[model samples]
Target: MDLSSLRFAHRFDQVSGSAIREIFKIIARPGMISFAGGNPSLAALPDEKVSELSVQVLRDHGKQLLQYGATEGYPPFLESLKQYVETAVGFRPDAVLPVTGSTQAMDLLCKALIDPGDTILVENPSFLGNLQCMKLYQANLVPVASDDDGMDPADLEEKIKAYHPKMVYTIPTFQNPSGRTLSLARREKVAALAAEYGVVIAEDDPYRDLRYRGEMLPSIKSFDREGWVVFLGSFSKIISPGLRVGYLAGREEIIRKCTVGKQSTDVHTANLTQAIVDQFIRQNLLPDHIRTICADYGEKLARMLGHLEDLAGLVTFTRPEGGLFVWAELPEGLNALELLKKAIDQGVAYVPGTHFFVDGGHENTLRLNFSNSTDDQIDRGMSVLKTIFREAK
Candidate 1:
């Protein structure tokens, strides 16, 4: 009767813990000033056109919209996505394949490459979801140290020379939790190192298009001369998170492998949603919508950053040019999770910095989302955070 002795695979044992989910319980309290989620600015939605496009598409192709579609994903969605990737991010069209969301693409990639004990190189403080799935495969999770310039290239090279991970997973553009972008020189180093070591890189970049400031950098997929990188993107940030649509772009052969693995996962993403989304994009609504979204997020991010100046001297947080997070590190003696208890008691909530670390050392750090808050909420939140820091002092 002992289930532990029944020999369940290690992946099952590894998949259960989640940091954000536990923190979410506190944010649900009435009057809480939540800085925890990475959700986008709702004002960024092209609300006017989404309804218009949805109505028109359904009226134009009702039957097709409802029917099952390709295992690789809906044709127009893929085609529109290919055009977007090539023109906006410099990826080749044949390389991208759609998935339920970037999360599923992450799962698919891990399934495709990892065998128990195989190494998967990750940023020391990396995406929680990616960390969760990699552990599911029971792969040797090696933490690659990172800073504001993103993952350290020399450290990455050293890891490669030593461990030879099956793949190096990175959130290169406006990285989650840290809101850090990989520097151009550092990026070139990563690409060269991957190619030189025959290591595969999984470039998860859902936040590239959400830039509220600065110039664009080409995606890692654009620099894959040796077919050494697999890039993941999602509409969840730019569009509706509820839609759950995302894609993977890489060498065609590798995508084909991911596609076979994807089949056993969801079979294919929903055709009806694909048809609706495809119609909106191919027919020209997505661009206008994204522009509106960027503008909304830009303003909100500005508000948060401007107010965050209050935390200066006592703390430091990332000022991202794009993406949906702001990472802050508290004073040496404070634990961010412990501070969250005080903050939540004061009606403010945030995820602890330790949740994102692979080896778990950044106890005083925390992530904030500027996208979902109003100006008033941001100002009030910062005032509260400042009070907390001052009190801790």
Candidate 2:
């Protein structure tokens, strides 16, 4: 019998691979100015500091870091991370589990809570990666409507009544692809709604620390009165994506279930990276480091916005207070997917906003990341996009 005749799991039936990864392959050509990924600026990575921290952690805890670690977390990191969450992140976590990245936190949450056909309410144009994660778990993803203030709580409550969803997933601060933040009032309402409806809220907030302007808002989890909210955080944006240190914080029971699920996943996040991040917190290195990165990224964001402003009536884009991406809408009937072919040919690339939608038919929009592009690159890439959209229109 041919092995090619084998049938795969039904969980994959509705799922296709990431569209962004496919775009990455096309833009890999030399001279491509990619606005396609949510990567931290190269200057923000702090290589020498990481090297110094690595050596220090190794000297202090070499044997344990080298040996097998707990599925819960590396010991020092667990302690430091909990303190950091309470003080810096503004929540008192009952339990916390350090995972490979916040990406894994999504996977483990789905594993812990989802069953085939279970409903998960999400923002209409939400983070694609977690949407795919829910699909892989055979979820019924229901789209909740959103405005500039982020997901509307009235719409969310209506969905909760209708769908009786198993979970509600949101990127409440500096949302992915759209760069919108949930308002303080809505944040409080969402937490209240979750408790009232007895639903789980997965507050994935990796980009919270990346804000370049305005006052910092409290997390949705901070307003959570019940055990219904879980906060997922990532060090990838602030430190190095290569380090892959991220965490899940929540009620002990829910966290325990994720911990059980994680045991079969990667077992635990790498000890070396956890220790390095631990030192970052214990030594109080993040405040100054974050300030430095914010300054550089702020300039880049301003440059990209300037280019977008030049587009004027031809297009409309979000003026995000802070975050890596700016969402843009081309004129109706001018398809971003179709325009991307012309853009790649012109040495520019971006993710079509259609892919971010739960039901996938908003062809007029696209997402552009400013953090990964330089002043010159943003100028060149946006010029290419403007030319393509103008000619297409």
Candidate 3:
């Protein structure tokens, strides 16, 4: 018998994510102008500031940081984080558990709540990573229809009644891939529904502060009267992604459960990173930093949209107020999967929208990221995409 014949866990039975991974590999080639990843602009990362903070924190408490720490979080970070969330995010969480990233926040939520075969309602085109996480937990991921206003409350109610799902996962503000925000009224409705149905709501809102145009809306967690909503936050968008600092905010009991799950996951998020982020919060550096990045990103967004205007009849795309991505749909029968190969060959790349869909049927859709590219890159890449679409037509 061969070692390859050894039995593996059934959790991996439906989790083959190789297609997009292959696309990412192509995007990494030299000279590739990639619109595939939701990465913060290099200019936005505070490398110098992070270095200063790291040295300061290490010099202050080097031993405690290097030694093993509690599963809950670093106390200094916990204090600053709670204040930041309450003031900036508009919710006083019963508890907050810092994690490696918001990605781990989702994983811990699943670990704490989901059991094999439990139903989890999701937006039709949700974030692929979390969708895969749900699949690994063996949860039944049912799709809910969405529009310009985000997940429709009516459809959500119908799905809730039909499936009686254990959880409802949502990226409420400036949602991933789609770049759509849930309306304010619907946010309240979602919270109310969660309480009525006894279902948990995972409100993953990493991009809330990335707004370029629209007014900021209240979080679903803010409207959560009961303890049903859990807010997932990340610093990857506004700060350095390599730092990998994010958090989960929810009721005490729920957070306590996630904290236990996190212990087995990665003992705790790196203490030095947490301390650096702590200094950022304590010094109130985010407002000015966010303002600076938003100015540049807003311009990039406008430039991309202007280029999209030239492709008017050829394509239609979301006009998002903020967030890193722009979702687009090509003319019917034109598959984005096929277009991607030509895109990569021409030194441009985008993620085909089909990968974002739960059931994976829409092939004419794609996602573009403007933040990572310079103005020249956006112009060149969009031109390449335009020529590809026109030739396909």
Best model per lDDT: 3
Worst 10 residues of 2 by lDDT: 13-22
State the local distance difference test value for candidate 2: 0.93
- The positional error of residue 129 in candidate 2, measured at the CA in angstroms, is 0.8
Candidates in order have lDDT scores of 0.83, 0.93, 0.95
Q: Worst 10-residue stretch by lDDT in candidate 1?
A: 41-50
lDDT string for model 2 (1-393, tens) is 999999999999988866778898987788899999898989899999999999998998999999989999998899999999999999899999999989999999999999999999999899988999999999999999998999999999999999999999999988888999999999999999999999999999999998899999999999998889999999999988999999999999999999999999988899999999999999999999999989888889899989889889989988888878999999899899989998998889999999999899999999999998888999888888878888898
Clash pairs detected, candidate 3: none
Please say which candidate is ahead in TM-score: 1 or 3. Answer: 3
**TM-score between candidate 3 and the true structure:** 0.99
Which 10 successive residues of model 3 have the least lDDT summed?
A: 1-10
Q: How well is each residue in 1-393 modelled by candidate 1, as lDDT tens digits? A: 767668776577756565677788778778877888887666665566667767877788777767766788877778887887777677775667778879999999988889999999998788898899899888889999898899999889889888989999999999988999999888888888888889999999999888878888987667778989888888888777777788888888889999999888888988766666676667766667777778878887888888777768988889999788888888887888888888888888878888888878789889888788888888898789888877987
**Candidates 1 and 3: which is better by lDDT?**
3
In model 2, where do residues sit more than 4 Å from their true spots?
Answer: none
Q: Give per-model TM-scores.
A: 0.94, 0.98, 0.99
- The alpha-carbon lDDT assigned to residue 79 of candidate 1 equals 81
Model 1 error, position 61 (Å): 2.7
